[model samples]
Target: MVSVHVTTEVFPFDQSVDLCPDNDALNFTTIFLITFGSGPTLFSNKTPADFNFTTSHSQSFTFDVNDGMFAFVNEVPDLNNGWHGNASDYTTNDTDGYMFLVNMQGIDPQIFNYKIDDLHIGRLYEFSAYVANVVRKEKCLNKPNIRFEVRAINESGNVIAKKGTGDVPACYNMSWSKYDISFETTHSSVVLLMLSNVAEGSGNDLAIDDIELRVYSTNDLDDTSTTASSIFDCKNNDEDYCECSNDFIGLSCKIQSDDVCSKHDNNTYESLFFITFGSGSDRFYSKTASDFNFKTDLKKESWSNFKPGAYAFVNSVPSSLTVLWHDAAKDHTTNDTDGYMYLAGVGNVNDMIFNYNITNLCVGVDYEYSAYLTNVMRDIRWVSVTEPNIRFEVRAVHKKGDLIAQKSTGDIPVYQHMTWSKHGLSFVATSSSVVLLMISNVGGHPGNDLAIDDIQLRVSSANQTGFCYPG
Candidate 1:
């Protein structure tokens, strides 16, 4: 007989076990109950202690007899001896000073059913246990292969959710490892935690301990603060809060921000406009309202000739330029479908420059300007520029020609293949009216011809605290 101790008022037990002369030396060969703060609790002191395990509770088991299939004991088998593999072969911390051992030949799969009640509807719960194969030898033919499963059952005995550990071999030399199974309950009902053997021979055996079931609320698993807003709110510091969108980081959402410009083109902002050869035809933008277009022309004459005030020129030299539109037969990549701006510079004359007069920008707000650039390749007859390096620059200027912010893609290799690359920079706007966006090829090399597309300028809304860059 085993003696039981009741310590907490919350847990009450009615059954009693006769005390053994030496409680520590008592080795029971049948299922029994041992009392402790954290170890497995008893369903009842009766013959079969199954079907009473509940949430947030644990139960411990041990082998009943040496040759018997299932048994419960207070200690692990001795080290490296027939039943015991090594001195250290045991459960984790041996909290209850007990463990359940399963003999492979007799009871290949030992099932334990738990009755769960008072569970909240639509709640998630985690069931886990520490399991290990008691075998220590690497080449031992009877290595214990075990698995743990958790299944939820409704009042009608219908299974709602089931999860399991397929196969966990005792390859860790008797060391204990945890197995976890989680399920979201649809209806308040019972849950079953089962442990079974995958190996069938006699030498295959396993030990299990520290079984636990825990319930968690949805709010506990959500990382985002409910008090924060989805979009960044830079103004109301007291009442306004922010939970930066994915890819955006920083406090106040003032740092690394989302790409305002994707692979698309649009006049979403009234101040936004594109520089093209004609009023509307051959626009240096995509034909698709929100898609990028990367089309080129053999000669600048194919479109309207460059006119002063319509386009920005760097060297004051007239050169042929065109907007490339998407043509399935010509474009190498489908990434830029609408079209892109192209410059066919004359040798020794660097004259490509783009200027836009933007209005109504928020003063003192940080903004990011970005665009995609690549070397255009049309046909074998088209001359390929092998400058090896190309430089692109962007600057924000006032109507008075005062430079507000300036950034550049220092130097990029002009590969022979057609591959578009993104370049961008962040800046703080100083004024709202007449903000000028200057896109230029600062390289002095005349043949620095390239294609530019998907230009965008938007306010940066990523958190900008302590060394964090704008997203």
Candidate 2:
């Protein structure tokens, strides 16, 4: 029999044996309960009485074998080897059917024995061993050594768990050896046991005694008693107060102590207004409400934010304004600045410069003539003089025709708006009398290739809208 070391007050196991106490004041083999001052107390069996102490009370207890007796001894002469059972039958092959053997030839007799089958799963077993060298050996003499091994095996003969050490020094004469083996089972199985010392030839003579094993079950472990806010109260696997998070594929779980990991656009008006033309690139600018000149292809136009109702004037030029006259005998090359303007390539048919004539001006009045031009690639020729060096001169034939206004060029580039003043002059409308605003090639050629964006001949302020021009 092997005994585990326990304090008279309370202490953990000191050997490799199952403990089964009979009172409530004691403990089971595999569990531990902690108390102040003393570190931890272990038990192999439950005690039947409560531990009623008043700091001065003394209680004493004793432990003895509860069930079967396992013995390892040699009855001389025939030499036994290990732990032996009582019953045997040679007809069935069994390890327990014969007596254990110990060879005592040329060396002293030796006995290495232990017991550990009583511990259950999730139990902590503490153990220690003692050995006596009955015949000390020095140089070809007898010396005894002991080894211990605990293997948890299932019913199918599989060794599922094992932990042990095999080197224990021997003691002279009647001596004691001690060791503690702690084991916990993760599966349900019956344990197989072995105790020996490097089983080989000669030099073996010792007796092993007082082997101890104590068990600690799962219920014996303690829980943290502090509050949640205390750092000491946190467990290793708890995630609420994580210290670090695992990182995988741009996603991660934060290990923050008390926080959640979170994706972090700013919207402004300056980012909205973008210039989309030119190259495929974009440029941003403040969207201001004002007039601007828009250009496309080879043509240019003046546009403004002001909208028009009914009709609008491009300068003093009216929308769809026209001039009309028909004469088969007249040369009609005279330049007229009465209520109309001219554009290049108008009447240069087959080299005969046929000028357009505005025929029926109200007699004896003033009127204003204006011209507008866009994308003027070359200098255009114009007859600005009222009197013709050819056949006619521009005079106010009506009171509205007297206001012949003219300007060389308007303030807007690619946009021309000139008015001819006819306020002080007047003339009569004969049958062949015609008005002209000639558009011949200036600086020596024809086909000036200029666009007349919007031209008009309206009474002053007839259908005027806001004009788009530079100040």
Candidate 3:
């Protein structure tokens, strides 16, 4: 077993076998899980998509003309002499197994990387993998050293945690050695897991298999400052099935916390106005509301000013201005189909980008107007003109009638990457009807390019009733 020194309390799993090649080494390398801290259904048996190595997305050693990086074999293959030929996989028992015949050569040290999403905040996770140093002890040039790094994907690649497998000694009769590490997650929901070969020179080759990662039990979370056992309140101390605390409502108390995860709860709110548009269609926006923009795309119109509803679904944005512009990132929706975003270059007037009128709302009830916007342009200097300024507004009757409530996203500064920010406002429905509008706060300038998405007007879940549109 690899001894890991993390901040959290980690109980060690002993592998008492000596590093020297010996008989009965097969059993020492293959215990997949100890099943200790977590319940019976502790680890997720299947491989996570983020960390998995597949044929199409091969993330491994540099492709050698002789050995060609890696291959799927039952055991260590014979390259030259039979030093590593004795290594056999003990985890997968089948004709086609999990063992990887890896060859590390050339300059690139990175083995592979994976993406993780929707991790529970402050929850403990155990990551483990099996590997066998392929080099013979006497002829070992460089002992295989592996490094694991976790970086937040959305936070402009900020590192959260890291660990290293100390120089793996040569051979368990050329058998496998297990490596494990435990980490607690922070607020970052999306992360990248990268495995890199720390050692340079030859004899750094290894056979790796049975890579696994899953959530395990923790006495407490960093954020909540309370034990998961107490928050879950499992019946009869059954941790698997339990009752959630406060606003948490999910199986095993593993849903998103922070009270507002259920803001769009299917039973709580009815989508009164879901902002959607057509393929540069001028008829659609004006058809819904006469006061909306007469046109969608502004490429044909003047840059001095823009009309209300003069918005277009600007889903695609070139990552760089040079050769890779064709491979721009699509809209923010995570579906199999292509989704579009409201892309706009706000002109001098800080134009009224959108307007929608809905009728017969339940008076005295609550409603929320929300939209996500991101600045598509960047600036080397901190010029405020390059940033995007968006406003979400709610009003009674017509577009310019009595204002109900409003909120403006001051100046959305340029981030290292395209990071979307959500802006919203809540109001009590004084009248039976209201108009929702999206206005630009910044006039035409150097950097007012914006991408907007997921615009919605929803009634409070608790106040949502069928009578909201009752005849």
lDDT of 3 by residue, 222-271 (tens): 32111111011212333332122221112212222222223332334577
**Compared with the true structure, what per-residue lDDT tens digits does model 1 show for residues 76-167?**
54534554432232333444444555455522244455655656665555555555655533333334433333334644454443323322
Q: Going through the candidates in order, what is the number of backbone clashes in each?
A: 41, 96, 5
- Which of 1 and 3 is the better model by lDDT? 3
Best to worst by TM-score, what's the order?
3, 1, 2
Q: Who wins the TM-score comparison?
A: 3
RMSD of 3: 23.3
Off by over 4 Å in 1: 1-68, 79-96, 105-108, 142-147, 152-156, 171-173, 197-199, 219-471
Instruction: Report every candidate's CA lDDT.
Output: 0.37, 0.24, 0.47
- For candidate 2, the lDDT comes to 0.24
| Shift in Å, residue 196, candidate 3 | 51
- Evaluate model 1: give its TM-score: 0.33
Best by lDDT: 3
lDDT of 2 at 91: 13
Each prediction's RMSD over C-alphas, in Å, is: 26.3, 50.7, 23.3
